[model samples]
Target chain A: MPTDVRLPENDLLALALDFLLSHGLNAPQGHSLARMLVDAQRDGSFSHGLQRLPGTLNTMKHPRFNRHADPAPESVSPAVVRVDAQFGFSCLAAERGIDALIGKAGTIGIGLLAVNNGFHSTALWPLVERIAAAGLVGLSMNPTHAWVAPAGGTKGLLGTNPLAFAWPRKGKPPYVFDFATSAASRADIAMHRNAGREIPDGWGLNGQGECTTDPAEVLAGAMLPFGGHKGSAIATMIELMAGPLIGDRMSRQSQDFDHGADAAPCHGELLLAFSPDIIGGAGVGEGAERLFAGFSDQGARLPGDRRYRMREVSARDGIAVSSALLQKIRSQTA
Target chain B: MPTDVRLPENDLLALALDFLLSHGLNAPQGHSLARMLVDAQRDGSFSHGLQRLPGTLNTMKHPRFNRHADPAPESVSPAVVRVDAQFGFSCLAAERGIDALIGKAGTIGIGLLAVNNGFHSTALWPLVERIAAAGLVGLSMNPTHAWVAPAGGTKGLLGTNPLAFAWPRKGKPPYVFDFATSAASRADIAMHRNAGREIPDGWGLNGQGECTTDPAEVLAGAMLPFGGHKGSAIATMIELMAGPLIGDRMSRQSQDFDHGADAAPCHGELLLAFSPDIIGGAGVGEGAERLFAGFSDQGARLPGDRRYRMREVSARDGIAVSSALLQKIRSQTA
Candidate 1:
C-alpha cells in the first residue's frame, strides 16, 4: 500500500490538467478547473482539492456532461453581466465574465454577474478573492444539490447553499469568508463517512426526521441548516437569489434534473461587486484595516487567516497527497 | 391605572407622528419615522414598533442629532445612489432615496443605495419590502452599536448587525426576512431581564467571558452571535460593508461617538436592489412560488408567514397596546 506523498504545486497542477484534458475538456476549461483545485490544495482545503477529482471525472463521463461547451457572457444591462455556462463547469464561465463584472463595477460603482446553467462544486472563496484582488467588495452565493432539509421539515428541500464575501484590504489578502449554510458541508459528512466516524449532534437527521449521529444515516436522509431557523432563512434566501432570481434550477429541481444519476448539480450563481473607491471615497482600505485589527486584538481568528497560513506552508513545502490517489489519476489517462 | 388599550392603526400612527413632531422633527422626518413604527406594530414586530420610539426621542434630544436637518440624495454614479442623512434619523433619508434606487435598478438591472451619516434603530424589513413591492429583489444590512462579541473572543467588539432580504411575489405579499446576527435580539434579553426570567444558554456571556443565563450579566458583558462562528463572520461582514466600506462608523467607533450618552449609533446602511425581470427572466416569480409551495407542503414555516398572519389580525382587530405604555406616550407631550 502506498502512503501519502508530497508533490510540488506545479506538479499537482500538471496532473490535474492532464486528467481533465484526457477526459475531453478543452484547454481553457481544463486549466480553470486545475487552477482552482491546485489553489484549494495549497490552502489546505483538502475536501475541495484533489479529493474532488474522482467525482469530477465521474461527472465528466456522464451523458449530460458537455465536454466541449463554450461558456458565453452577455451584457444583459449596464451593470449586469449574465454568463451561460452552456451546461459545463462554472469555472471557465466565471473566469470569462469576471473582468466584465469588475469593469462595470469600476465604472458604475456597483455591478452584478449572474451565472446560469452551470455546475459548481468548488469553493466560492476563489471567485470572491479575485474580486477583492481588484480592490472591490464581493458577495457571491450558489445552490447545490438538494441534500439539506428546511428547518422544521423532515424532507430535503434545500441545498447546502453556500455564501461567500470578500472585502479588500491594504498590503495583505482580502478579508474573505465562504461557508455553507448547512450545519456542516456535504464534503465534511462524506469525510466522516469515509473515515467510519460518527458525526456530531445537530449535523443531520435520519430518514424519519429524527436526529442522527451516524454519518450513513444522515447521508441517507437530510442535513440540517446551522443555527436552526436563522440559518434556514439564510439558506432559503440563497436558494432564491442563486436559483429562481437568476432564472436557473433551484436545489430540488437541480436534483430532479439529475434523475438519480448523482452528477454535480447544474444551477446558477449570483455575484455582486461594489467599488470601495467609488462608493466610500478614499481611505476605505484604511478603515478596513482597523476592523482587521479589532479581530486580531481580540485574539479572534480572521475567517481566512488559517488558510493563508497553510498557503505559506505549502509554498515552503509541497502539498501532501495520497499516493494511491495520484496513481489512480495516472491510470485514468493510461 | 388603565388596562391594555386597543387602538386603530391610524390612531397609532397619529400618536407616533404627534410625539415625533413635538420632539422637533420636521414634518417629513416625523412622518417617515411614524409610518415605520406603526407599520412594524401592524406586523406585530412589537420590539421594533412603539417600543423603539422612546430611544428615537432620546436620540433626537441628543446634541449629535440634527433635528431639522434635511436628508439629501445624490447620484454618485450610473448605478449608485448616495444619501446623506445629515446626522438625522435614517428613515427619512431612505425615503428620500428609495425612488432613485428603484429607478436605477429598473434601468440597469441592479442598483445600490448607500445611506451615510445616519442613525438607525428600527427594523430593516420595511425598506426591503418597499423594494420588493416595486418588483425588485432587495438586500439591506447595517451595523449598530458595539453590543456583541465575536465568536471566540470575550469582549464586546462586534455590533448586533442586522441583515434583511426580500423577494417580490405576484398576487401576494413579498417573501421577507429580517434578523439580527445575535443569538437573541437585545430587546429579547431586556424583556427576559424585566420579566425576571433567566435567558437560554448560548445567548450571551458574562463580564468575564463566561457563558451565563443571567440577562443582567449578559447585558453588562457581551451578546453572542447566532450560529457561533458562522454568524460571527456574517456580522463582521455587515460591519465592514455598512461601516468602513461606505465611509461610516464601525460599531466601536459609533459607540465612542455617543460618548456615554446612549443615543442611536450614527453609521451607514447599504442596500442593493436587483430587478428580476432584467436578470432572472419573466418566469422567476413562478419559480419562486414553486419553492414557497415546497415549504408549505412540508409544513415548514416561511420566514415572514407568522408576521403576515399577525398583520391580518392587526388589520381586523386593531392593535392592542399596554395601557401604561400608551399613557407614557401621552405623558411625553404633556
Candidate 2:
C-alpha cells in the first residue's frame, strides 16, 4: 500500500515553481504553471496536479519547446483578443489575456479571446472560474492530440477536446463544468494502464476497430466520444473552433508535432466571455440562484460542487498525495 | 400502409403559408413560419417540417398566444442584440436580428443575439446556415419544454435544449449540426408513440426513474440527457445561458407557462456569430477544407452531409409525405 503524504498548499506551490524554474521556464511562466498545478491539487483535481510535473519536465526536453517565449496579446477588434503563446505554456498566455477578455465583455457585453501556439495541459475550469469571479459568464474549449475517433470511423481523427463553461453567482462559488468529449479521459485510461486494470466497455476500440478493454490497446487505438455521435460532433466543433478557426494546429498536427515523443500537445484555445449585467440585466444573480437551488433541492450535485467541497477541505487540512508520488515530485526540484 | 403524397417544394411552402395566414398570423410571421417548415421538409427533417403544423395550430388556440405581435430588435451593446418577440413565434424575430448580428460580427469579430419571449419551434439549422452564408461561424442554442432529467436525478428539470453550430465552407454547403442534448429528441419519442413502437433503451425513464422502452411512459416521466453526466452538464449550461443569462424562461418555467396544454414553449433563443476574417486571418476556409478532407479520407461523413444531400434531392424531386397527413394540413387551411 502506498503511504499518504500531506503538504501545505504553499509548500506544494513553492516546490512546483522551483521545479519549473530549474527546468528553464521563465519567472512568469513558472508562476503561472505553479499556481495552476497547486490550485488543481487544492481542488482535488489530481489528474492535472503535481502528478503532471514529470510530464511537464519531459515536454520541456523537446527541442522545439521554447522555454523563454513570452506570449503577446493583440486586440484584433472591438470584441476579439488574439494571443500568440509563442510556443510556451498556455497558462501565462491565458493569464495575460484574461483581463482584456473580461474588460471587453464588460464594455461590449461579449468578447472572445483566442490563444494560439500554446501547450495546454491544465484543466480549463480555472480560467472560466476567473471569468465568473469577475461576474461574467465564460465558455472555453480546446483540441489536444488526436487520440479519439470521429463517430462511425475507425481511425483517430479527433482530440479529447474538452469544453468548459462558467456562470457567476452571488456570495458563493460560481457554477462551472469542464469535461472531455471522449467517453473516458486520457488520464483515466493512463491510470487504468498504470494499475494494470481493464477499462470499462464503450471507452475505446482496438486498432482493428474492435472494442477492447485493454488500456494499452486503447492507448494505441482510438477512444470513442461520449454519447456516441453527438459527443463526436462536439469534439469536431472544438477542433474547428480552436484549431483552424484560430489558425492553430489541429489535433492530428499537434500529435504529429510530438512525433511519438509523448510530450504535451501544442495548440490553440478559444474563450468567450459574456457580461450578465449587460446581457441578463439586474435579475441575473437571483435567476441563477433559482436554478442552483433546483439542483441542491434534489440530491443531484452541480458539476463543480465536489471539487469546491474538496477545495475547502484542502484549504483547511492541506493536500494529501501518495508518498511515492510526493517523493517523485520532490526529487524533480532537486 | 399509408399512401405517400409527393408535393413540389413551392406547393408545400404555399400550403404552409396559407395555413398560418388563415390561423390569424400576420404576413411576416406567416412567411417566416412557412419558410422554416418548408426548409425543414426540404432538408428531410420531417420532425420540424409540416408535421409540426398541427401542433402550431393547437398552440395558437391558447389564450395567452399572441397572433399579431411584431418582434422588435434592439442593439443593447456593440456586440449584443436583444430582440423582444412580443409573445409571438421566434422565427421572424430571428430573421429580424440576423442582419444586425452579422453586421456586429463583421465589425467586432464576434456578436450575440438574444431573443426573448419567443415561441421557438423551428429547427435551428436554418438560422445558423444564414449566418454561415454571411461567411461567419455561428452557434445557437435554446431551452424547450422541461422533459429531461439531470444525469443522476429522475425528475425532469432540464430542456431537450437543442444546440446548433455552423461553419462556412467554400464551394459546398456549410458544415452544420444541430441536436438535442437529450438521449433522443422529443420528436423521435413522439414518432415512436405515433407508430405504436417501443423506444430504444437509454432514451428515458419512467416516473420511478427506472429505464423503460415505452415511449408513453417516458413522455409521462422524463427523458435522459445524451452522454450521461457530460450531456447533463451541457444541458445545464444551455439552461443557464439561454434562460437566466438572457432573462428568459427556464425549461421548467417554459413548461409551466403551457399550463399542461402542450402549447409551444415560449422562451428565448441565443445565437453567437464569429468572423473568421478577423479572428483566424486568411487561412480559415482552406484550413477547414483540410479537416473536411481528413474526414472524407477516412470514410467519415461530416455532420450535416445527410441533411444537405437530402436537400439536393428534395430540390430536384420535391418532398414526400403521407397522403393522410397532407389531407389533414389541407383541411386545416380550409
Candidate 3:
C-alpha cells in the first residue's frame, strides 16, 4: 500500500521558511532558500525537494559551515561577473548571479557569470527555467563532490556533475533539461539499495574495476558514466570548465565535509544566458514563436513539459509526501 | 591481410592534394581538405579518413554538392560572427570558421560563429583541436540528416547530431573529445550488416518500435540515443540550439539529398571559443602549465595524447587504404 499524506503549498513553504529562520538564517536568506526548495518540490524533483531540507539545515548548524555570509560580485567585464559566495547558502548567491547575467543579456544579447566558493545549489533546472521565463536561453554547469569514476578508472575522480540547459518556447513550458552525466545517480542507487533491489550491470563497477550489480559495491566504489566513454568525456569537460575555469578546486580535491572549518564544500557554477533578439534581428521573436508552434503541433513536447504538467496537477490537487518523510521533517524542525 | 604501405607524410599529403585538385577543388580548398582527411586517418578515425575519399569525390563531381564555392564571412561582431558557406564543402567551411573564431577570441576572450548552408563536415574534433591548439577552449555542435529516434518516439526525429569539445593544456595536446549522441552510429551498424553480424539489442528499433538485432531493421528504422533518455535529452537540446536557433531546417524537415537544388538540406553548426586569460587574468598561462604538469605527474594523460601519438606513428609510416577502396577512387576520377 502507498502512504498517503497531503500538504498545502503555501503551508509547506511557510513551515520550511520558519524552520530556516529558527535555525539562524537571516530573513532574506531564509525566504530565498525555502522558496527554492519548495519550488523543487512543486516542480516534482522530490529527491532535491523537501528531502534535502533537513540535510541543509544540519549543515548550516554545524560550526564549520557559515550561514550569514553574503556574496559580493566582482566585475571582469560588463558581460562577465564573478561572485564570491563567502561560504553562504548557494541559493542566494546563484540567484544574484542569475539576475545579473539576465540583466546583461537583455542589453548585450549574451552574458556569462561564474559563482565560486559556494555550497551545493540544488536543482539546476529552476535556475535555468527562471532565465527562460524571462525570455532568454540559459546554460549552466556545476561540479559536485566526487561520486563517479572516469570511463576506465575504478577510483572516484569526478562528481555526478549536473549540466542544465533551458530554452524559451512560445506558448508551452520552456524547454528545460537537467541531468547528471553519470549513468545512475547516487540517490537512485540508495533508493534501490533500500528497496532490496539489484542494480543493473554497467551502472557502476566494484572497487577493482570489475562491473557489478551490487548496489553496496557501487556505493563503496564509483558510479559509471551514462554511455561509457562519451558520458565520461562530457563530465571531464564540465570539470575543466566549471572547476578550473571558475578558479574553484576540482571535485577530487574538494575539502572534507566532516572537518570543522574545512567542512564547507565549495562548489563552482558557470552560467551563460543569451537573448535571440540580439542575434536574430527583427524576425527573431516571431520566428521563435513559429518554430515552437511547429514543434508543439508535430506532437513534440518541450523538455520540461512533463514536469510542468505534473506541477499543475499537484497544485490543483495537493502535494503528496511519504508519511515517514513527513514525520521526519516535523521531528527535525521541532 | 592488411596492405603494407610506406610513404613520407609530405608525399601522402601531396598525393591526396593532387587527387582533390584533379577532381575540382581549388588550390587552397584542396590543400585544406586533403590535410583534414589525412589528419583523421592519422588520428585513427579510419571511417572518416581516406576511406571516405571515393564517396567525397563522387559527391563533388555531381553539381549538387559544390566544391568550388567560396565560404565567405558574412558578418562579424566582437563576440559573434555569421558565415555563409555558399554551399561549399563543410570541412573547408569549418576550418575557416574555427580560424576566425580563434582569432576573435584572442581579443574578446570568447567568440561564437555560426555557419549556415554547409555540407557534411568531417570529424568535428579536428576543428576544435585546432582552436584549442591556438590556446583557446572550443566547442562545436552540428545537426545532420534524420537518423536517430526521439526518446519516446520510434521514428527518426533527429540527426546523429555530434558535439565536440577541446580544452587547451600547456604542455600537452588539447583534451579533445567528440562523439555522436546515438546509441550506435549508422556507420557501425552498416559495418555489422556488411559483415553479416547481428547488432546488440537496444541499439536500434524497427518501424514498429520493437527491439531488433537485425542491422537491416536499423537501416529501415532509427538508431537509439546513446544512454536512452539521458542521451536523448542531450540530443534534443543540441537540436534546439544548433537547429532552430540558427534558423536552419531540422531533421525530417530538411530537403532530401537526392532532390538537388530544390533540396536545400540546411545543416547548422555552432562554434564557441574561450580564452583562459579571461578567467585567470595574468596567471592564465602559468596556471594552465601547472595544471597540466600536475595531471601528468599523477599519471593522467591528456585527452588527445593517444591520438597525437598515433598521428606521429602514422606520419613515420604511411597510412594504408584498402585495394578495393583505392580502385573505386581511381574509377571515379577516370
| Residue pairs clashing, model 2 | none
Q: Sort all candidates by DockQ, best to worst.
A: 1, 2, 3
What is the per-residue lDDT of model 1 for residues B22-132, given as tens digits with 9 covering 90 to 100?
888889888899899888888878888887777787688678898886988899987999999998899889889999999999998988999998888588999999999
Q: What is the iRMS for every candidate structure?
A: 0.9, 0.9, 3.4
Question: TM-score of predicted model 2?
Answer: 0.98
The window of 10 residues in a row where model 3 chain A has the poorest summed lDDT is: A255-264
TM-score of 3: 0.92
What tens digits encode model 1's per-residue C-alpha lDDT throughout A198-225? 9999999999989999999999999999
Off by over 4 Å in 1: A1-3, B1-3
Docking class for candidate 2: high
Error of 1 at B229 (Å): 1.0
Q: Tens digits of per-residue lDDT for model 2 on B1-334?
A: 2427677988888898989898898898889999999899888888888888988986787678789988878999999999998888998999999999999999989999999988876899999999999999999999998799898888899999999999999878999999999999887898899999999988999999889999999999999999999999999999999998999899988988989777898999999999988899998888788778878887888889989888888778778766787789889884
> In order, how many clashes per candidate?
0, 0, 0
Each model's lDDT: 0.89, 0.89, 0.73
List the candidate 3 regions with Cα displacement exceeding 4 Å: A1-3, A61-64, A255-265, A280-302, A323-326, B1-3, B61-64, B255-266, B280-303
